[model samples]
Target: MKTLIVIPTYNEGSTIERVLNTTLEAIEGDILVVDDNSSDATKELVRNFFDTGRVFMLERPSKLGLGTAYIYGFRWGLSRGYDLFFEMDADNSHNPAALPWFLKELRGGYDVVVGSRYLHHTISVVGWDFKRLLLSKFGNWYAATLLGLKQFTDLTSGYRCYTSKALKAIGLEKIKSNGYAFQIEMVYRSHRKGLKVAEMPIIFYERGGGGSKMSRKIVREAMALPFKLRLEAIRHIFKDNI
Candidate 1:
């Protein structure tokens, strides 16, 4: 498959370079950095790799949400006939060393391959304090239970790979969540669309640089999105039956 890894960035100048270097070394796929007009040197850092002939960038006007950044990248990849796509963070938290595993799973016929911090009841996270860990665990539980995605161990994991078929099946334009909820919605839509979803265990380290983007607004949106998706599903079923 012709793979394209889409990394979303916003003010991650400190870690973006390392992430790019490692990602280039770790996989054979080309990279597309979807930058949301990072005020810092994020864009410049990514541009530095353009001479490699495999690195690309799509610059947005302002600081758009995470979901939009990815959607933009997906559309770009699809238009150019890329076969596989990836969602990775600019933070070093999502290790580039695991990209090969994700690609392997996708090649093995999984429509969506999720890199999970908690897979099969094991927590593989590092650098998080107890409270942060608890919050992540509880958040996953809450999302999985409400969204009927309990089979997935980590619903909010941002590190994932999607075959082009899965991306096409999910109707990307209809994805409305712009925060971490975007991750949950992708899996939920994949499940609802009958795509094969597989989980891969990965060790998630806290970001080495840049401030955390988590905010109360993003958290509130994540909390509300599962219900919204559930209701939408119900409405679709009702409409279909009627």
Candidate 2:
């Protein structure tokens, strides 16, 4: 199976090289770095990997939303006839070692596999303070509860793999969120569309460098998106009955 790992990066020069090397070592796949215009040496660092031939980079004009970057990468992979696509972080928060496990699950006929830090009532995160941890837990609980997606333990986890069939089935054009909420929305849409979704436990390490992209705007968007999604589903049901 031809797999493409799509990493969205912004000012992550401090860790991009190591992330690329480790990811390439872990899986038999090509890597695509979707870099938002960064002031740092992130782009320069990514270019250094191009000699490997399996690494490619796409430069955007500016810092686009994370969801849009993945969507861009997904489309790029799809056009190139890739079978599977992955969402990974460039800051090394996501372990590349778990990639083989995700691919195994996909080969076993699952459409989407989420690498979750909280699978089966267990918290498997490190390097986070209590307040941060509480926010993450509460956010997951809030989204899952409101969207009737309690079956998933980490709806907002960005570490995930999806088959090309699953991506097309979920209707990429129909996805609405463009921030962190995008993760929650994708899983919800996949489940609603009858795709098989599985979660595997993973240890999430906090970023070793650079600041978080999380802003008040992103948080607010995440907070309100579930209600919007729920309302949309209800409206769809009502329309069908009419």
Candidate 3:
């Protein structure tokens, strides 16, 4: 199967090179970097890789949201006839080597596969604060309970595999979220569409080089999920559907 790994970057100079090289070595697939016109040398470094054919880069006009970055990458992959696609972090937080396990499950017929850190004791996170861990676990629990989703443990993890058919089913034009919530919205819509989703365990390391871009605004937006989804549920209810 032709697989494409889409990595979105924004001023990730400190870890980009190592992440790109390690990822290339780890996964046997084509790599595409969708840079958000970073102020750093991220674009220049990636262009060198693109020249070799193994890597490709897309320079957006500006720093769009993460959702748009992935959307652009997804469209690029689909246009190239890639059968499998990946959503991975440019920082070394996600293990590229563990990607094969996801492909194994995908080829075995799963439509979507996520690298779940909580799936087993063997793949625990190396370094994480108690507060961050709580937020993650709490967020996943809340989303699962609110959306009636089953099985998958991590909702915010970017480390995931998408079978091309699944991507085709989750039409990019229908996706609306533009940031962190985009991941949640994707999985929820997948469940609502009756697609098969699986979770595989992998250690997720906290970022060490660049500062975290999280903020109170992001949290506030995510917290608005219940109200937003609840309103949508009412619409579906009135329509006599799910």
Tell me the tens digit of each residue's lDDT in model 1 across 1-242: 79999999989999999999999999998999999889999999999999999999999999789998999999999999999999999999998999998877776778999999998789999899999999899999999998878899998999999998999999998999988899989999999899999999999998999988888888899999988987888899999999
Instruction: Give candidate 3's error at residue 25 in angstroms.
Output: 1.4
Q: What is the lDDT of residue 107 in candidate 3?
A: 70
Model 3 Cα lDDT, one tens digit per residue, 37-106? 8998888888777765789998998988788899999999999999999999887899888888888888
For each of the candidates, give the backbone clash count: 0, 0, 0
Q: Kindly report the root-mean-square deviation of model 3 from the true structure over all alpha carbons.
A: 2.0
lDDT of 1 at 200: 92
Model 1, position 127, has a per-residue lDDT of 94
**Cα-based TM-score, every candidate:** 0.98, 0.97, 0.93
- Model with the higher TM-score, candidate 2 or 3: 2
Alpha-carbon local distance difference test for all models: 0.92, 0.93, 0.83
lDDT of 1 at 146: 88
